[model samples]
Target: MFINSKGYYIPTKRVDNNYFAKLNDLSEDWYFKRTGILTRARASEEETINYMSIKAVENAIKNLPYDIHEVDLIVFASYTPNDTVGTTAHIIQKEFNINNAKAFYISSACSSAINGMEIINSFFKSKISSKALLICADRNSSYSDDRDTQSGHLWGDAAVALFFSSEPIRPNEASILDINTLGLGNVGHGPQAVTMEPKNGLHMPYGKDVFTHACVYLARLTDTIIKKNGYSISDLTYFIGHQANKRILNNVCHELGLAENKSLSNVEELGNTGCASAPLVFAQNYDIFKEGDLVCLSVFGGGYSCGTCLIKFN
Candidate 1:
């Protein structure tokens, strides 16, 4: 699908590393040394997941040439839900006053946006819809315990929206060429490493293991997509990864011989927004890429999931 436009919303309350360090009883530098996150934003009570998501889509539709009511489908992605029953996609659709559009939600952890795009790609290829909307939102601050040291300081609130068309709405629009994904779920392997308990309903992720897997697997997944698509490593112009960890992204770029400038990230300043990370990065950086430039997106997170998509700018 051709990307017509995108919109991003990051919470206004910015918390610095010092804030997390004090809570963890560690030095400020320790936050950087380990997670590489310096600051992150937290959503206010008024800025609920659906609120931010609707705001994001408002900006997206405003920027695009299409009407909101004309959108044929909506795919929503989120890891942190504000409720137990209602799907956020349906909420967004109803708020948009769109009754005819088909909508669904995916909670595929951090790789959710990529998975959403994959579904959009298929719809375009199958000629099922001419226009679609994809929204990824995460309000991780709601679920994370502020007093906990491990998973507490590692999340940010964010929402990103993308409008897609089967054909380019503009001559210079960027479009996804392919999406490759991997899900390794052994009987006891994946979710055990990163989980939210039913008893306490708190996020509990094994940081070191997640970091190790993120670096190696994201690198491999990215490389595999590039090569399989007949694009040389030298052909990639930008790498927008999931805002999981700055260190993991850096290591992946280093392994691929990619320069620092070629890799774009917000993890240091925005923490990890789970599913919204990659799309938010893309919405912010897509204009920097020149026509015909090949850009790659790679994301890894819980469910032991990793996904990569290669996009071509026209």
Candidate 2:
């Protein structure tokens, strides 16, 4: 599969560390030192998951070389869907009048976007669809507890839209080289590490465990995918890890012998935007990617699942 175009939408409301300080008595200096997060994007009442995704598609469609009607598959990868029955994918299909596309939703925590793309790749491989659209968004504020000291300051809201085709459709597009995904539900704290319950809200009782295992799996996935494709760490032009924490990203970079500048990050500004994190980074930095550049996206989500995708600009 090849990437045709990408677009993203981040909420305008910026929540700083002081908000957490006032709400949870966590000092700005302490928070910044621990998480390297100064401010995060928070969505307003109007910026629901559907709204943000629609806006992102609008932005992405502007750069699309083909017509919107060419899309035959629409996948909305989000754990924070506003309505389970009427999902964002269906909404996008309806909004764009893509009456011929198959639409649905999927969730594997933060790794949902990569998994969704993998599904699209499979569909293309099976001759089921030639063109696909992936919309990933997360409204963490909808389920986050502002008073919870553990993760109150770590949530953010954003959305990204990515267009894909089974074959190279345009010049300067990215070609999907390989995709590897793993479900580590039996590893470490697993499901108990991070919880987002309706009654309890989002909490990380085992944040330390999450951080430890995330660093390991993210690095392992990236290393495996790159090596499986016969490339070395130094050959990777850019690395985009799951935007859960700065420390975790640093740990993965260190483990992979990757330099600081080579690793792209958005957690510092967007906090953890759940499934939207990695793709949002790609969309925001799409113009910087040159032809022949090798990019790797590795992600570890709350369900203890991890995945990696290798793409090279063609």
Candidate 3:
């Protein structure tokens, strides 16, 4: 499938490291040295997951190549659901008045977006849909506790919208060359590394374990995807890893022998945006991607999942 249009919405409220420092009694440098984040975006009461998602879709569809009614599939990929029963996907479908579309929600932690995209790929390959909309978003602030020192400061709110078609709708669109995803429920700390209980809020009991495993799996997925596609690391024009941490992404670049200059990220400014991280970076830098450029999106998420997507800009 070809990604025809992309857009994102990052809340305007900025929460700096000092805010966390005061709340957790940790120095600002300690937070930055560990996570490589200076500030993060926090959504307001009005900026719900569904609201941010719709705003992102509006930004993406500004230059839409097809009618909204033609979109046969709508997927909302997020772990922080506004309403589990009435999914954000259905909200979007109804808001846009999409008359004939199948809407659903899926989540695999931060890897939700990649998994959603893979499902869309299958739908197209099976001739189940010609046009699709994938909205990946997270309202991390809703679940995180500012007083918790471990993972409370690692989250930021954001959303991204990606429009896909079975065939290229425009010459400048990017083609999905290949996608690879894995469920690592038994790897490293597994499901115990991160947990979000309704009463306990979001907490990371195994921060060190997550960093170690994320570095390994993200690089592995990126390298495996590139090599299996008969391409070398040198051919990659850009590398966008999961925006969980700048340190993790930098380590992945080092392991893959990819230059840090070619690695693009917003984690330093936006912090970790959950499932919206990688795609948000893509949408933010969409204008700079040149024709024939090879871009790789590698991600690792809390459910102990990792995935990679190789795209070729046309």
Per-residue lDDT of candidate 1, residues 155-202 (tens digit): 899999999888878787888888977786652257876777655544
Q: Which prediction has more favorable lDDT, 1 or 3?
A: 3
lDDT by residue (100-164, candidate 3, tens digit) is: 89899999999999999999999999999999999999999999988888889999999999999
Give the candidate order by descending lDDT. Answer: 3, 2, 1
Give the poorly placed runs of model 2, Cα more than 4 Å off. none
* Residue lDDT tens for model 2, 242-311: 9989988999999999998999999999899999999899889998999889999999999788899999
Q: TM-score of the candidate numbered 3?
A: 0.99
Record all residue pairs in model 1 with backbone atoms less than 3 Å apart, i.e. clashing.
none
Candidate 2 worst ten-residue window by lDDT: 22-31
lDDT of the structure predicted as candidate 3:
0.94
Better of 1 and 2 by TM-score: 2
Candidate 2 lDDT (Cα, whole model)?
0.92
- In TM-score terms, candidate 1 sits at 0.96
Error of 2 at 256 (Å): 0.6
Between prediction 1 and prediction 2, the one with superior lDDT is 2
